[model samples]
Target: MERILFGDNQFFAVNHISDEKSRAQAIKFQNDVEIIKTLDYSIDAGVHTFMCTTHDRIATICDYIRSHPAKYEDYKIYPCMPYAHKYANAVTELGIVGTIKEYVPNNFMGSLFKGGVAIMSKDYLSIMELMIDAEMKMFRNIKTPVIFLQNVITDLLLGLGMTEVLVAFHKYIRKKYDTEAGFITMNMPKLLDLLEKAGVENPIICTSINKAGFRMSGGKELYETVLKTRKVRVIAMQVLAGGAIPPKDAIKYICSLPNIESILFGASSRGNINETVSLIHEFDKQYQYDILSNF
Candidate 1:
């Protein structure tokens, strides 16, 4: 069945850490309680699939997914585990039942991470063919690496791999255009080449493009360049900017972007979830924004 997978990068509910009593509750619960609470809220909000980050968090998340009867029946969970000693526990833990997916991020961050390949569903491949050439044009003067996970995983799945997980996922790319000064350029062109070379046939490659906190100053320029070169699709994130952007304003700003396909926000509380959903729906109903003069 075709599914519109919604990657929930930051789904942990850390609301209770605001005050003493809440802080105490948070201590008692650790991150697991908050995670469970988040799962409940996300399920209620109608998220079809989740792309979880961190290794240690994946087990707790999987446990919650397994325990929740409703969520288990409806949604899919893909946990991204970075390669570090801290994550060993989650990776080797027993009783996983092979239901949740496990993935890894590639060498660099931005469009070249291994994480990119894991989420490339079949539908994404169909969309890439038309956009490959255009995507290549965007990085004519840039140097970076690109790889797609869609074709990479086909063989593993066909071979009946032990787990549904795909390790070595790349999400973003970093280029040392200025070594002494230290500036990282997101190598979009290299990524497209890798996807094409790998035969990563996916119509849409969802990007976790956060707009609030960590932003690309040339977002529209990059988007337009890439869009002009290839068929482009983005999953806008960090609308709250790691709590920097106010929820209301964040929603408003995300709603204002013309290129965004979906603004996937993280909500820990039912109220917040409701607010976000209402905002998206409300904004969609009256969604109108002029391409800024900057773009």
Candidate 2:
């Protein structure tokens, strides 16, 4: 994972703080061209990995990246799966069978049969794999090094005590997609415990690690303790705590943490992107300096 991973929340009108800002962002990125241009800004600022949801518009971005290979030769996308709204809207418009037909891979009948059998036999693991395949279709020709389970599903599975699904997702992605599986969750401590107990070693998890503990489940102290003690690779998101903390302060707090392998954020402009990247670098250097000084 890159030290800094760009996110797609802003592109998809996902503002955690202000509804007005979300509406403005929706208007600004109404076109795929605008989204692509903003992504280019991030690339130009030295952020190469895009951590994003598999929203319908992302297919257009993937198409653009596929069309211009040379420009994005080193770019990587970490696709978070099962964009719930996409399915809900699809089901409303196309019905369940039609929704499956629209999203599933080209092996239409084969996948549908498998999905049906999985549903009938209550083999939800197979259904999960099928849904992963369906969500992954748009990212077909792109360089996706890590596939992620979104928190909407991850937390739900956690609450349901379905750690088997997590293990299944981990194994399925490595087996079928030839990529590592990542999980995004709001509750880091509980998920980590479950993953470790399930014999998943050094799992990759993306979650909220912020100064204000805005959306961080299990509180911030437990998260810090886990980071200090655990063997997991954590990608910190919501570091700004929905604009509660200043950028430099937020980055500084995150950089001070242990076992934070990556910092994920979204920005609509080059200045914001550059500032965040620069702050991460600056604080990272400072953190290393402090460690060396203690030595």
Top TM-score prediction, candidate number: 2
Kindly list the per-residue Cα lDDT of model 1 for residues 1-295, writing each as its tens digit.
1122233333332331245545554454466777667666666766555544333455555655556556467565432222133334444763221111232222222343345645444334222222222222322332212222322232233245412122112222112221111011233333444445544333234343434424443463565456456644444545566566666776776666555554545554678777777777676555643334345
lDDT of 2 by residue, 1-295 (tens): 8899999999988999999999999999999999999999999989999999988889999999999999999999999988878887899999987776677655744655767755535655665677788788889888999999999889989999998888999999999999999999999899999999999999999999999988888788999999999899999999999889999889999999989999999999999999999999999999999999998
Runs in model 1 deviating more than 4 A are: 1-31, 67-71, 83-190, 193-213, 217-220, 224-229, 256-259, 288-295
Off by over 4 Å in 2: 88-119
Least accurate 10 contiguous residues by lDDT in model 1? 176-185
Global lDDT for candidate 2? 0.91
RMSD of 2: 2.5
